[model samples]
Target: MTATLPFTPPLALASLSGEADADWARAGAEYAGAAFLGGIALDADSRAAARELVDRDRTEFLPDDPLAFIDRELEALAETPIQPAFNVRSATVDPVVDAARVCRDREAYLEINAHCRQDELCAVGCGETLLRDGERLARYVDRAAATGATVGVKVRAEVPGVDLPDLARGLESAGADFVHVDAMDSESVIADVVDATDLFVIANNGVRGGETVREYVDYGADAVSVGRPSDNPVVLERVRDAVARQLGLEASG
Candidate 1:
């Protein structure tokens, strides 16, 4: 059976900065269906890349032991009503597998980042580089799935020559449970991806009010996630109410 999210309005808070920890998630728990923590760097190469991101004035989660960090963070959210998920970046497959095992034990979620377009991370083959290498990403998803954790991939839109829908299909075959799409400016692509695979689709980018939420819902997105402004109570309240209304509209139709 395909895995499902219990989000009533199907909205989530996207991981921002490696600083988006358990505390940040808890603060937004009442407004979110799930909370993604970290674009945590795992393994040596990805760690170095994360340091570079830090050098560029970006905050990253650079724990001495990433697996232990995952365990502790998920444990912190064990009592929170929101589903706790980790968004990880790794150049090697082993760290991803190990992290998935930790999430499995905690019954949290694991999201592979195929979304970050940072040149430093891409140079190490950790982020957007995976979008260009479908075979490797499928391998990562397949291996992570074997760990029995709920797995999803965060992908961006408008990458030159990359077909998002096709990629979603391959991920589904590889056992991914969901696809988190940062729909840059191509909001309609969510429909293509939804039609292309059974993986639950979470449409992201500029989701603050009824118009944006309704657009994604019209495009068939199963859920929507808030990014930079996820902590804004005004925005979250608007999105929450809009999504609930959309769900009601769908139910009545």
Candidate 2:
């Protein structure tokens, strides 16, 4: 069954690191709803592994202490007045625990990134690597939730041989507040995830405009995220307005 947030704004920002500036102020101001910024690495190991790879459509800079780096990034946008959520990851659970501890009182979510497919990240048992280890991922989510900060798990929908429904159910059982799925081209995966878990489902991948936003919401996703279109200010605004119109919600700056 589908769930609803406390409030649903017309627009929601999908996590975007490459297009956003040092401070995500502009992205925050882009819409008054959710802003999922940064797929930050949470420890030295993951950072080093990620840094070893060439930059793709992602940010290549890796900080020695990734948690501290993300801390500053969040601090930059802390006062943005939107629903702020940061996507982060490591091979193990400690860094996620540490991040949740620090961001506990900030009301921001710490999202576990099981959505990245980078070769280097996968080599370190981070990113979509976790997708191959459902048991470990469950424990990881359990530890993150133990920190008392809101926990969300971002996942890739098209991983071969992976049972997406079972994984979503496991995450929900493990106490994830949100299960974010990059549905790729399969919107049916969104529906399956919704059936498998009661946690809020966030549908991503090729979400271009308000129509696509409504399409996912109609498919039982609690929310939807966009990538490339979010970089275009005018297009973003149009999409946001369209979301507002479709959802019968008011549009905001």
Candidate 3:
């Protein structure tokens, strides 16, 4: 059966630090029907200094290789009851390796990072730049699928020359399991892309509450991912109700 879209809060596990233990996962899973693990940032230089900073601030799971760190974290979460999914930051480097690791472990899903707009990341030809190179982006999707993992590519809409509908169709045709659109402050952009693609859609970016999520769902999305919003249970609770109502599921509250 196709996985039902999460109804409760839909735990959007904020990048690694956002979820430190099973309690966080359990809480999110209980409140949100699904959980999304925050992203693992990868740099071309594998900058030790940057990696150190991430380690100091993000999580204790940090490793010399950020990709390896992500692999280890997914392994650790394998025993948990909460369904797990991972997001990669600027997934231009060795995405296949990362997807292979996840596939080896049989994790729930793997998301590509095409939405991050960090200056440092963009400068390195990662993040949204991947979209500019449709050939490479399509190859990445093909590689991810070759790993036998459910692959989804997350992208920011509103980038110059980056047509959301066209990109979504490209990703879908390249074997992506889903096309994650970062709608951030653009409802029209979201609606346009949603209307254009038949692929599973995960709407994110600037989603503040149930009202905002409802708006996106109304536009056409299979599910909406909540990140910063998940930090506040009250807000997540509100979103949960909205998602439930939209999906015709019983509200937990």
Question: Quick one: best lDDT, which candidate?
Answer: 1
The alpha-carbon deviation from the true structure for residue 54 of candidate 2, after best TM-score superposition, in angstroms, is 4.4
* Cα lDDT of model 3 by residue, 202-238, tens digit: 7777666667778888887777777665666777777
Candidates 1 and 3, the one with greater lDDT = 1
Instruction: Name the lDDT of candidate 3.
Output: 0.64
Clashes of each: 0, 1, 3
lDDT of each: 0.89, 0.73, 0.64
Clash pairs detected, candidate 2: 15-36
Superposition error at 152 for model 1 (Å):
0.7
Rank all candidate structures by their TM-score, best first, as comma-separated numbers: 1, 2, 3
| Total residue pair clashes for candidate 2 | 1
Which candidate number has the best TM-score? Answer: 1
Ranking by lDDT: 1, 2, 3
Better of 1 and 2 by TM-score: 1
Off by over 4 Å in 1: 1-6, 249-253
Candidate no. 3 TM-score:
0.81
